[model samples]
Target: MPMAAEEIEAMIRAAIPDAHVEITDLAGDGDHYAARVVSESFRGLPRPQQHRRVYDALGGRMGGVLHALQLTTATPDRGV
Candidate 1:
């Protein structure tokens, strides 16, 4: 099954309370998505680590509920 944008956003928010997340269904299918996230928690994290953190929030749902995710994580105006 595919995941909902709200669910994805909620997962991210749960992980990073201060994060601003925008989830989109890129393929018009719930499984494929793109998320642009801005968070204070990403302040000192690297790009790869930032992505991993978002994935971690999904809790292994990557290949199951979520098929593909194009993620962009940053900290306010600064890129993570």
Candidate 2:
């Protein structure tokens, strides 16, 4: 089954409590998504590491039930 946007946001929020998560369905198909996550927890992390954090929030659903996520992450102080 495909994952819902709210579910994705919830998962991220669960992992990064102070994160601001915005999820967009790129293709109007539950399989593709674009997520912009802003969080204080991302402050000192590099881009790849930040993405890794968001992925971890998803709990290994990235390539299985949820596919093709274009993710952009940033700290609250640094706009990306």
Candidate 3:
């Protein structure tokens, strides 16, 4: 069974409380999703590490219930 968008979002939100996330359904199949996450926590993490943080948020569901995730992560800009 594919994961629900809400479930996916909730998992990530729980892990990164200060994140700003946008979830999009790529194929309407529930298995493929595109997520853009902006967080202050990403300030120093490298690309691979940033993605790894999100993958970790999924709690090892990447290859099982969640098939594919196209992600774009960055640090949110504060008023400057």
Candidate 4:
């Protein structure tokens, strides 16, 4: 089953308590999503590492129950 946007946001929030997560259903099909995650914890991390954290929050759902996520990460101070 494809994951819901709420589920994605909840999972990320659970992992990163202070993260501001915004999820958009890119295809309107519940499978392809675009997520923008902003958090203080990501301040010093590289882009790839920041994305890894969000992926980790998904608990291995990527490419399985959840697919095609276009992720963007940033710190609160450096909005993107």
Candidate 5:
């Protein structure tokens, strides 16, 4: 079964309480998604690390229920 966009957003928000998360379903399929995550906690982190934080929020669901995620991460001032 594919994951719901709301479920993905909730998971990220749970991990990063202060984050602003936007999830989009690409190709009209729940398996393919694009997520924009902005958080103050990502201020000094590198791009890879920031992406990792969001991935970690998914709890290892990346290759299972969630197929593909095009992720964009940024800080408040950085903008999406």
Candidate 6:
């Protein structure tokens, strides 16, 4: 089954309570998505670590129900 953008956002929010998440459906298919996640928790993390946090929030759905995710993560202090 394909993942819904709402579900993705919910998962992220659940894990990172202070995050601001934006999810877009690219290719008009639920399988491909673009997510922009901003949180205070990411303030000191490297880019790779930031991405891993969001991926972890997905609960191992990255290559399964959620096929492709073009993720951009940032901290609110960075003006994202």
Q: Please, what is the whole-model Cα lDDT of each candidate in the order they appear? A: 0.89, 0.93, 0.90, 0.93, 0.95, 0.94
Residue-level lDDT tens digits of model 4 in 1-80: 88999999999999999999999999999999999999999988999999999999999999989978999999998874
lDDT tens digits, residues 14-58, model 3? 999988888998999999999998889988889899889999999
TM-score of each: 0.92, 0.95, 0.93, 0.96, 0.97, 0.96
RMSD of each: 1.7, 1.2, 2.4, 0.9, 0.8, 0.8
lDDT of candidate 2 over 1-80, digit per residue (tens): 99999999999999999999999999998999999999988887789999999999999999999988999998887654
The alpha-carbon deviation from the true structure for residue 32 of candidate 3, after best TM-score superposition, in angstroms, is 0.4
Which portions of model 6 show Cα errors greater than 4 Å? none
Task: lDDT winner between 2 and 5, please give it.
Answer: 5
lDDT of 5 by residue, 8-31 (tens): 999999999999999999988889
Error of 5 at 28 (Å): 1.0
TM-score winner among the candidates? 5
What digit string (tens of lDDT, one per residue) describes model 1 on residues 21-43?
A: 98889999898899999998888
Regions of model 2 farther than 4 Å from truth: none
True lDDT of residue 1, candidate 4? 82
In model 4, how large is the Cα lDDT of residue 42? 96
Distance from true location, Cα of 28 in model 3, Å: 0.4
| Model 1, TM vs. native | 0.92
Q: Please report how far candidate 3 places residue 18 from its true position, in Å.
A: 0.4
Order the numbered candidates by lDDT, best leading: 5, 6, 4, 2, 3, 1
Question: Lowest-scoring 10 consecutive residues by lDDT in candidate 5?
Answer: 71-80
How many clashes (backbone atoms < 3 Å, residues ≥3 apart in a chain or on different chains) does model 3 have? 0
How good is model 2 by TM-score?
0.95
Model 3: which ten-residue window has the lowest total lDDT? Answer: 71-80
